[model samples]
Target: MKYLGIDFGIKRVGLAVSDETGKMVFPLKTIHRSTRENLFLELLNIVEQKGIEAIVLGLPLRPDGEKSLTCRQAENFMHSLGRRTSLPIYTVNEAYTSLEAEEILSGKGIRGKKQKESLDQAAAMIILESFLECIPYERGLK
Candidate 1:
């Protein structure tokens, strides 16, 4: 089954996807929060086109491993997304995924604000990849 991964943020949401085998994850796009309604429509289109069966959302938690205001916000967003799609939604702890993305990009010589924007999508890719690694492929099938 194919899966969509969301890295939710205040200003943008990064997207990543897994292949049919659910073994490979790839960065897809970033949707600006200001245009999220449109973003949802676009994502719906992708779901239909790609035969997506599930969604994996990155749940941001505080450093102490507690849910924060930001985590609540992400939860609300996930609930809304669930209402809009028939696919099953799942969450994974996403602490420091963005920092990891930044480090990876920096090592590759990427710099500045532009790199930060790309990091958003990169982080989503990392989140999805990790989530994919943890779950057995057979379990993903409904």
Candidate 2:
């Protein structure tokens, strides 16, 4: 099933999408936070337009795997998002995804403040990529 992966933040939400086969996840775009209604409506538009069958939210947990304040906030956001869309939503542990993204971009010489700004997209990609790796089909059914 096609899936939309979201890296949610208070200020901006990074988005990614999986192909129908769910083998690859591609960075879509980032959306600035808005009124609850507006955010949900916009996301719904993308879901419908893209034929998204499911949603995966990235949960920013602490390094030791503990839920932090941000985790609670993400839980609330996920609940609200599900309420608005009535679609199945899943979450993947997002510890260090941002840092990992930063390291990757830095390796490519994406430097300075610009690299920081790209973290959201990179984190979203990491989140989706991790989930992608777990799929049996994607990993040769191993």
Candidate 3:
């Protein structure tokens, strides 16, 4: 099944998608957030177009696994999103996703403007890839 992963941030929202086989994950696009309603509408359109069967949201948590004000904000966003779609929504601990993305880009020689532009989407890709890796274990746990 295809999946959509969201790296929701205050300024930009990053999106990533998995192939129909659910094995390969890739950065899709970054949505510049001007308004909350518009962000939701954009997500709805992408979900429809991508045939996303599920959503994995990157829940930004503290190193100690505590939810901060930002995390609470994201929770509210997720709840609002739940009302819009029947697809299963899941959250993954996304503590250092952005840092990892930065490191990955730097290793590949991406810097400055290019790195900044691609960072969020790369983080979303990491979030989605992490979620996909846990699927088998998650299913077994079920």
Candidate 4:
């Protein structure tokens, strides 16, 4: 099954997708959040275009695991997205994913504005990877 991973932000949203086998993940693209409706439409289009079967959404949490305002916003986004799509949606804690993404980018010699532009997509990849690690994959089905 193909999966879509999302790292939601107030200003920008990051996206990633898993291969048909669900063993390999790739950074898709970053969508600038100009408006909620526009973002949702674009996401829906990607889901249809990519044959995405499920969604893994990153839910921001405080370091201590408490829900913050951003977490609430993520939940709201999840709810809105759920209403729009019938596909299953799952949330995973996204603590430090951005920092991890930055480190990965820095290792690749990406910095400054370039790094900032790609950070969310990299983070989404991390979030999706974490989810893939937890799920049990069968031989014939992903």
* Candidate 1 local Cα displacement, residue 92, angstroms: 0.3
Question: Clashing residue pairs, candidate 1?
Answer: none
TM-score of each: 0.89, 0.89, 0.96, 0.94
The candidate with the higher TM-score, 2 or 4, is 4
lDDT scores of the candidates, listed in order:
0.87, 0.86, 0.93, 0.96
Q: For candidate 2, which ten residues in a row score worst on lDDT?
A: 130-139
Question: What TM value does model 2 have?
Answer: 0.89
Query: Once superposed on the true structure, which residue ranges of model 1 sit more than 4 Å away at CA?
Result: 137-142
How would you encode candidate 4's per-residue C-alpha lDDT over 14-63 as one tens digit per residue? 99999998889999999999999999999999999999999999998998
Per-residue alpha-carbon lDDT of model 2 for 3-94, expressed as tens digits?
A: 89888888888888999998888888888887777778888999999999988889988878889988898899899887788778988999
Those runs of model 3 whose alpha carbons end farther than 4 Å from true positions after fitting are none
Best by TM-score: 3
Off by over 4 Å in 4: 137-142
lDDT of 3 at 109: 100
Ranking by TM-score: 3, 4, 2, 1
Model 3 weakest lDDT span, ten residues long? 133-142
